[model samples]
Target: MLCENCGKNEAAIHLTQIQNNEMTTRHLCEVCAEGMGLSSGSSASAPLADFIAQMGKGMLAETVSQPGTCPACGLSLADFKKTGRLGCPRCWSVFDASLRGLLRKLHGGTQHSGKVYLPPHPSESDRTARIVSLRRSLTRAVESEDFERAAGLRDQIRRLEAGQEA
Candidate 1:
């Protein structure tokens, strides 16, 4: 495909933009796409550089400066930053606001409304056996005083329970 803008260079990028309820699709080569302020790399063009700078500024503005606190254990975002671990499930709820900003930075935005396909239907007995194994692992972790491992097992058990319920 040829670039829509250059009409000479072979297109290597497809960009779609929605404006005023109308969708516009453009096919462009890397150079043309960069010229239109779409590439992530630094551009020599003043307009493209300015647009990228503004986007960076906007992202910086949206970042969470204040630390979040876990409601259950009173653990703070600073705690997670230091240890890279969460206290409990309740930490998710408490840290959600701040985590959303971090997630957006890492993943582009807080939109995970995507599809996930599962097996047609696993046997109930199979799920039950898995839950039992997870419970045993959790018990062992607790007995060994490995709280982190126990927490992971607990979360797995909870997910299994939820899947079974569904």
Candidate 2:
């Protein structure tokens, strides 16, 4: 599908935003999405901020200000929309509802799916350190969407478990 914003590049990012019982949808290309700071490298808060902004464009604009603002930092949904950055960590709690939906959309599931690695080393400390290293590798694999490497990591973890049982 063509990008809603540019109408030139193919839309790769499909966003459905809901706020105050209102829903708004936008399909954007990588470039357009990046322009709005909605690209992959952007911070976790960007999509939620953008989604809130899109939803606010309709009837909820005025009503959202008071309740939507972070009590600690005084960062409103409007401020998030403008900056694409949350005022502080407290903003996460303040806007938890909105961010949850955005997160579900971005990731297939809200729960962490990345595998944890354990090693079969004799020394407990060595095993712990190896597990930490392997977990870091697994995290990078999942983040990069490298299914092959992730599968390998899973298999390695399984082998470690089998060795432990023996």
| lDDT over C-alpha atoms for residue 137 of model 1 | 88
Lowest-lDDT window of 10 residues in candidate 1? 40-49
Clash totals, every prediction? 0, 0
What would the per-residue lDDT of candidate 1 be over residues 1-166, giving only the tens digit for each residue?
A: 8999989999888888899999999889988888877883333345543544444344434546545576679887666554445679988777676566656765688998667977555677788889998899899999999999999889889988998442
Please provide the root mean square deviation of candidate 2 (C-alpha atoms, Å): 16.0
lDDT values, one for every candidate:
0.72, 0.71
Which stretches of model 2 miss by more than 4 angstroms?
A: 1-66, 120-166
Best by lDDT: 1
User: In model 1, where do residues sit more than 4 Å from their true spots?
Assistant: 1-68, 118-166
Pairs that clash in candidate 1: none
Model 2, C-alpha of 101: deviation from truth (Å): 0.8
